[model samples]
Structure formats: C-alpha cells, structure tokens
Target chain A: MAMDEAGGAPGAAKKFLYVNRKAPYGTIYALESLEVVLIGAAFEQDVQLAFLDDGVYQIVKNQSTDAIGAKNFSPTYKALGDYEVTKLYVEAEALEERGLTADDLMEITFEDEDDDWAEKPSINIVSRADMAKIMSEQDVILSF
Target chain B: MATLHTVNKSPFERSSFISALNHTVPGDKVLMIEDGVISARKGNTFADLVSSALSDCSVYVLAPDLAARGIAEGDLVEGVQTIDYGGFVDLVAECDRTQSWL
Candidate 1:
C-alpha cells in the first residue's frame, strides 16, 4: 500500500542493478538494500539484484536472530516477486568459498505473466566472470 | 621496522582487505581483526588472494576474533598465523607504524 508513491508516472525505464556485498545482520546494509529494491520496483524500472561474497548469506535459510534481538526479516525476501522485482543473481564463487550451496538458500520465485503465468526461479547462480559482465551492462549501479 | 597493516573490515564486504594487501611492501605485515578475519578461512573465495600476499607479506589473524566468529584454526588458510592480544601488541611495537583499512 505504501509503495503507491513510486507508481507515479512511469518514465523511460532504465536498468538498475543493486549490488549487495555485506553479510546479513552484521550491519543495516543488507536489509536497507532490500528495502530500496522493493521500493524501487514500483517505478517500472528494469531492476535486478546481485548477491556476492557475504551478501550471499543474506538469503540463507534457517537464519535466527533471537540471540541478537533483531527482528528476523529473512522472510520478507519472498515478497519480492509480488513487487515484480525478480532476477536475483547469486555468485557461485561466493557460496563455494563460504562452505554453502544452492540447497542452503531460500526458494524465491516469480510468475511469468506472459507465459500463461508459469512459475520461474528468481535466484540465478552465476560465475564471477558472468557477474562482471552483467554488472557492466547496468545503466546504474547502487552499492550496499 | 616493517609496517603493520591492519584490516578491520571483511574482505567480502569491501575492498579494504585487498587494498591493504596491494599496499604492502615485501617485508610488511598484514593483520586481520574484527570481521576482516573472514577472508582467512581456507575455503573462501578470498583465500587465494591471501595466499598470494604471503610471498610478500606475513599474514596474521586475531585468534579471539576468529573464535568469536566460530571459525576454527584448522579451517584457516595455510601459513596464516593465529595470534593472541599479546601478539597483536607485539606486532604494533615491532612495526615502524600501524596502518588500518576501514
């Protein structure tokens, strides 16, 4: 309901890539970026997310924040598809070195409206080289 | 005395670790503290980067910090020396100056 502000007149849509490089819960960077991504999606922009290094940990399942007394917002990521902000690029190298695997991440998907509403995965595991190329193609890059 | 280069940020979070490594001299020492110790893990993507710096700089990690993060000594990269607070103090005294990377 609050996202209505971003739905003002849609201008020429530009490619916006938000790069998340911080670990979840270490600071406010991870959650802040997600918030911006959700709010930004309302503008009819070509939005995407890139999770690398510690950023990959943001989507890890079974995240518990009770000890830290912080509100667990991990569940909020599942709502991104409702905002039409899919395309989450996860660096394969980041997971390998962190002793994590694709199986460890939360399942996030979106429905393809054009293809008779087929469900498609938003989490795309990509190589570092491919990540580099994708980043270069973005019209604007937002770092968090 | 050689310089003591300290990195307090996680390598994965920023370029601080790599920047510190790039600025080191052949005999300089690099110490990881706080979240910077994350890069010292043997299996992480940055392990090779740390290993490459070993030929030119002596790499160290704070044992307490690593323990706090639940990273075992055995899981660290080869040649990465683990030290206590006293060792950290000694490094500061042994070096000409201490430089920190945010």
Candidate 2:
C-alpha cells in the first residue's frame, strides 16, 4: 500500500467525526453520543460534530425545558468548545429549514479555518462529497 | 469504503432508513440500533429486503437493543454481528462515515 505524508496509509491519522441527525433529548442516543465524543476529546483525538435535519434542534438558541421537566441540556453543547471540539457545523440547508442562523445558535465556537482544529487531529467535517471522501479515509465511523 | 449505516427504526415503519440504505454503495457496514435493530429479527419482512440489498455488507445488532426488545442474537437473521457498547465504539472507530436514519 502507498504511504502518505504521515507515514501511515493515505488517510490513517484523521480522528472520528460524528453525524448527528436526530433531535436532542427526544431520545437518549444523541445525548449519549455527544458524551462519547467528549470523552474522545480527552484522549486528544480530534472530534467534529455536524447537525442536520432535526439534529439542528440541539444547537437552537434559548431552548426552554421547563415545560417538559427535562433538565435543560441544550446549553451543554455550547460547552463543547471548552473541550477543544471546535469543528462544529450544521448543514447549510438544515439551518434554513429550521429558520436558524448562527445568531440563533449558542456560540459553539468553530476553528478559524476549516481544518484548524488540531495539528494531528482525527476528527473534522467536510462538505457532503468531502464527507464521503473523509468517510472513505477514516479508520472508523459511527452514528447514534 | 466500508461505511457503517446505523438504522434506528423498522424498515417499513421508517422509510428514511430504507432510503438511506439505497444511497449506500455495496460492501458498506450496516448496523441496527435503538428501535432499528428490530428489523433484523428472523422471520421479519424487513430482514428480507436488507438481506437482499446489502448481501456483501456486514450486518450487526447492538446486544442491549436486541435483548431489551426480548430478541436474542440467536433469533436474529444469520450473519449479523451482535456487539456490545465497546464494540459499538470500535465499529464507529472503524468506519469512515455514519449516516443515522431516524
């Protein structure tokens, strides 16, 4: 097999990127997945998160859980930046459908440039086509 | 690319999943989770379609999901990899991308 600049296979070092498409709190899966990603960051692995479709609800600004008695967890996503998980992305179109803009989000910061998350990070997001390429390049992938 | 497609609902009840599978290229990995693992139970109709479409792909079920629903690995369609939470992490770590069909 041909080797790449990293001395591994062409795409061996990239960290795991998770695609979360479900509404948060509706099911335990999304929350659990986020927890796992947070743990991955502790190991210094690169982790990127993308919210599309109903998943955009997780990032919606000012979500009130008082009606449902659910302990407001939406704010926790904002704290992901504190974990150094800066590759936060939402589908350009999903945002429109949900009538959300960056203004409507909770300031979950992103890296200055696209791939600036880490020097040897294993996680990040790409466009849909690039997502496919990254998927092909990844050593592992998971969805929850 | 050995993509892992995790479906979380029944195939008939949740068409988004089948549609998601339609986008998958052959040899992709397909794992069932949450309510989606039910589709792989033996004698189920959805199992037939999944078996036909991604014959070359590896099929798997989350052990907790199957057990909670009163289904067993032995009750699943032949060849599905019944895995635990750690295995689930390994599965995510092994695939390049994951499309969750809700």
lDDT per residue (tens digit) for residues A1-144 in model 2: 121332355544456667677777788867887888888877665566766556777777788989987777876776676787877656655566667665676665544444665443212323444444444454445565
- Residue B4 alpha-carbon offset, candidate 1, angstroms: 29
lDDT of 1 by residue, B1-102 (tens): 376778888987878687567556668899999999999999899999999999978999999999999999999999999999999999988875565554
User: A17-110 in candidate 1: lDDT tens per residue?
Assistant: 8878778888898999999998888788889998886889999999999999998999998999899988999999889989999999999999
lDDT of 1 at B45: 97
lDDT of 1 at B38: 98
Question: Candidate 1: misplaced stretches above 4 Å?
Answer: A1-10, B1-102
DockQ of every candidate structure: 0.03, 0.25
Candidate 2 lands at a TM-score of: 0.57
Q: What is the per-residue lDDT of model 2 for residues B3-78, given as tens digits with 9 covering 90 to 100? A: 7777878766766566455546667778888888888888988777667754767888899999999997788887
Which model scores highest in lDDT?
Answer: 1
Instruction: Output the worst ten-in-a-row residue range by lDDT, candidate 2 chain A.
Output: A118-127
